[model samples]
Structures are given as structure tokens and as C-alpha cells.
Target: MMRVGAVAAMLRAGAAVSLSEPELLGLAEHVRPGAVCFDIGAAYGMYTYPLARLAGPAGQVHSFEPLPVPYRILEAGWRAIGARNVRVTNAALSSSTGYQRLRLPYRFGLPIHGWAHLEEGLKHPGSSAAARIVEVPVYTVDRVCELRELPRVDFIKMDVEGYEAEVLKGAEWTIEQHRPALLLEIEDRHLGKYGRDSAEVAGSLLARGYRMHVWHRGRWNRADRVSTRWRNYLFVSWAAERRR
Candidate 1:
């Protein structure tokens, strides 16, 4: 989940603004011109715009955001920039394609659109409560890739709350074939909502020869173990690792 303040700041910064944070700047190092990138759980087009800029006019950027409010904002931001390389999808990506209840959690009487998720039957921390439940269509990355006829996928940045594992499950074909670099947000608490853990998520990728790297001190540091504190991690294939 994203922070409300951060999301707001990014939206105010506009699509043309350049990224300054080290972690965001680091993504530019991995993405090359003509790269095909996916920004899953793109709240307000924070990473989507930068990815579109990095991919350039020749490349394609697919951004997914299930929530209606943010989806509209994401769409508006994309249009505001008049970018032709980006495609905004108003759907969530999971293991199966269907409709699911998207929880819009609220705190202090304000909806925390940033923490909105698809996990049902889980208690949120603080005063976070579901302000609304909406049925949003879901799709698998493989299905979308097949439908869109994507020649190749160079990179994927996913932050679908606790459903990261489920998304990976559906994206197996894309992962195996393209071996694209994956930047994922995995938190133990969030995973608990779906009866999952970080290891279960990382295990599947590691088994497929994807090495985990933590962003630290303005660089990607390879790690055999997941960071106990940080939730964001970059996973790359053995071939990409060799290139690095």
C-alpha cells in the first residue's frame, strides 16, 4: 500500500516532473529505450509517468490501477501529458480473471485510497476500515500479454498489496519467457491478509533463478535474504544478474 501524503505529492508534482528519490531514480538505470514496462498498482501514475518517459516514444508502458478514484486520476494524468506510449488499465491483476471486492480502507474518517486492497476478511492496522466495497474486474498478466500481443516484457513493477503472490502465479508464463526484471513490494503484515508470507512469495521466484536485490545507499545490493525491515525489492533473472 502507498502513503496518502506521498501519493498526493506525486500527483501535484505532475507527470512531467522528474523523479528525485534514489529508489525511483534507480529504476531508470534498469529501464532502457524501447523497453516494455508494467506498473502494477500504479496509484495516481507515480511510477507510470516515469516509466513512460524512460521507455520513450518507441516503447510501451502498461499501468494498472483497480480503484475508480485513482484510476480516473491515473488516466487523467496520462492524458494530461498527452503521452502515446502509456496504456492505463482500470483493473487489478491476479491469479485468475474475474470480479473481486476491492477494499477501500479509511482512517480518521478519511479514506486512505493508498491502502485500498483486494484482500477480504483481514483486519487492518490503526483505524483503517473499509469505507466502500466495489467489484472490480481482474486479469492475469499472461492473459493481458496474450491479448495485447506484447512482443516482449522487459520490466515489471508490482505493488498490489498482499496479492503479489497471486499476481506472480498468473504471470508465470511472462516471467519464464521474458525473464523481465521484477520490482515488488512485499510486506509480512500485508501478506498475512491472504494467509501468505514473504518467503512463500520470494521462494517461487528464487526457484526460477531470480536473485533478490535490495536498494540501499543509492545502489542495488544483491541479497540472499529478504530485508526484514524494507518491503521493496528488485528481483532479476540469472541472465540479468550476469549483465549487472
Candidate 2:
């Protein structure tokens, strides 16, 4: 028998229109005209649309969404807007190139696509959200850049649930080469599902000469504490910092 959420999802599967993108303060700061940007876990092209606008016609926005349903929606949304600068890919970014089980979790009998993740062992405590698994193609950020022959990368926004660390690992080469500003969504509850912690993720970037910052009071403030009220963090490399 199909789940209640699955039935509901099928009903809305053909809907190409995307919900309104949430207002994210400071997202425009990292993106610049003619810059190349990456939107990992780009569900329904929420950030992709805005990133493309900020990057302008000379810029490029590479969006990655692995799930079949969300991928379809994201593709349609971008196409509807005639976003010629945005390139949509139906794949997941990880530490290595391979296939992995993607967990699509539902809450209160409704599909919460943003909460979908790649961690199979994830257990959402105190939540009745059940997940259904699907195999997804995975590729490294380095591999994608090489395959695309990208000249440079300027900014990246990653929100792959608890898989941020794996994504960062795959993007090491790109980070070192381009020194692009990174905006990542990090939460302890999500990382704990994969037996990881926020410290480890922040440490990896910090060790790479990146300064962590959070958006507060309409500005980017240096994040002294790894964990902040806002789960999203901006990691600016020293090179980019110096240029700014």
C-alpha cells in the first residue's frame, strides 16, 4: 500500500509552479555579477532563481537536485522563468562519486522535501516523520567542475540536510582553487543523524583558512560560536576576505 504522503505527492507531481522563496538575508552578498554559483540541494529552484538574477546574464548558476520529484519541479521552475544562465542537474554531490540511498522524509503525513537527506541511518527523534528511500547518482564537486570546464566559481549555497560535510569534502579542490564564498546550512540535530557534529564541519572549513560568519542585525558578523540562532553560516576564505 502506498503511504498517505506518497499519494499526496503523486497528486502534485505534475505541478511545476514553485512556492515563494524565503527571504534569506545576505544571500546576495556572496553572489556577484558574472560570477559562477552553485546551489546544492536546490529543491524547486528556490535559491537558484535568485542566484541567477544576482549573477546576471554573464554569470552561471549550477543547481543540483537528486530526487526525481523535486528535480522535475526545479527544472520546470527554472525553465518557466527562462533562466538561460541556470543549469539544472538531477544528481547529488558527495565526497565521492557513487550511488547512495536518499531518504525522503514526511512530516504530519505531508512531504517535507527540504528535510530529505542521504543519511540512511537517520532517526528523527520526537518526530513521526517516516522516510522512503531511493537510489540517487552522486558526483563530486571537483568532478563536475572538471567536466563542465568552469573557468571559476564565485559562491555556493549548500543545504543538503546532514550531508554538508560530505559535500564539503567533495568540494575541497574547488574551494582551494576558487576560494569562493560558501553559505551552508548546519544544524546539530541533522548532523547527529549521521553520527557527525557541527564542530567537525566548521573545523574542516576553519582549518582551510576560512572564517565563519553569521547574518545578524542586517549584517554579516564574525561567528565566534560555531552554533548560532541561524543555522546558516557563511564561510569566506582569506583570499575572498582580502578582496572584499
Candidate 3:
């Protein structure tokens, strides 16, 4: 579970490490030397670890992940980096503060593996690779903020497969409270997975006073990630505007 070198390589390769942080190309312009960052759906701490480095000793980074395997991987990976400012939480975010079964998108080229297109929506519940269910505690961004007992967050990076909309919904209070900038990944196929569409996710961001923009599209040459070839939508607001 602890794939230290593997995951660390990912961070070094330019993973966001936090949604609030910009992608590699725009990182220097968007990120500050000491800013708090929240990484949602942190698979292996790829984004969280580097974020700690960016935040330096004064900044803080937090990762929220519900998938058990990935969560453990993240724990060990972050430990390897020795970023004391980083914190990892094994919790999923949804529209409300409760439970939800997160279906893993099929692994590429696994013969019997479900089609990777299930990001479009799971045609069957039993197609999961684990072949067994994994229950992960779920939370709202608001709940996370409350539990952390913090006021005013600097940034929030969110990529919860197809649940981006739901995650944003649960973070309503956090959005209104901190007004953190957002870098959200949106896949039409993944949106369909949760019986929704990317437009809905985009609409949610639009309503939150964010100046919306598409950073880039995730076009993989191979069937790499479950979210293969989805567009990544990034949102940022000027400090003065964010305060509004």
C-alpha cells in the first residue's frame, strides 16, 4: 500500500497537490509562498506533499480522501516527505454530511475490468475491481472547516471523480465563509457516472462568484486515469473580488 517512490514521483512530476494550487504551467503565478491549501480526493498525496513544500514551514496543507487503499498510500507517502504541516483525512465529500458508495472506475485493459467509460456512469454496481464494497466516511467541506475549527481558507482543490458538484454543494458554507479559489476537474463521462452532467458542475462554480476558465483538457495518450481525457476547469477570483 505504501508505494513511496511511486507516489513521490507523481508529486515531483507536477501533480496539483492541492486543487487551490494551479497546474504546473501557471503555478508560479497562482500560488503563494505560504498559503493554506486543501486537496480533495487526494489519491496518493501527490498534490498534498508538494503543497506543503510550497507552503513552507508557515503554510498548512490538508488532504481528504475516502478510498482506503489510496488513503493508506497517501499516509505513507506524506510521511515519507516529512511535511509536518500536511494533514490527511480519510473522508469523502458529498452533497450532505453522510455516506456514499464511491465506485472505482475500471482499470484500463483489464480484460474483465469494466469499461473505462463507466466514468460515463456505472451500468452495473457489481463491476467494481475490489469485487467487494468499501465504506468510507463522508463529510461536507463545511463540516471539514468546522471540525478543523478554521476561518478563512486560502484555496481548495477538488477532484472527486464525478462527485465534484456534490462536493461543492456540501461546501456551500465553506465557499461563503472562506471564498477560497477553486481548481476543479470536470469530466463529462464522470459527471454522467453520478447521474449528472459537467454543465451542472460548471454552473455550480459560476454561481459561486468565481471567474471561470478552462485551464486545460486532460487528454491522455493511453487509457491512463479513470478520468482519462477529461477537461480540467480552473476557477480563481481576485483577492478583492474574492473578499466580496
Candidate closest to the true structure, highest TM-score: 1
* Model 3 lDDT tens row, 21-91: 23633433444667778898887665676566665677777898777777898888677756677889887
Candidate 1 clashes between residue pairs 3 or more apart in a chain or in different chains: none
Query: Highest lDDT: which candidate?
Result: 1
Ranking by lDDT: 1, 2, 3
lDDT (Cα, tens digit) per residue for candidate 2, span 45-86: 657766777787889999999999989988876666577888
- Model 3 residue runs over 4 Å out of place are 1-22, 105-130, 216-230, 238-244
The runs of at least 3 residues in candidate 1 whose Cα sits more than 4 Å from the true structure, single-residue gaps closed, are 1-21, 120-130
RMSD of 2: 8.0
- Residue pairs with clashing backbones, model 3: 17-47, 17-48, 19-157, 20-157, 119-189, 121-193
For all candidates, the clash counts are: 0, 0, 6
lDDT score for residue 185 of model 2? 88
User: What is the TM-score of each predicted model, taking all chains together?
Assistant: 0.88, 0.85, 0.74
Ranking by TM-score: 1, 2, 3
Error of 3 at 172 (Å): 0.7
TM-score of 1: 0.88
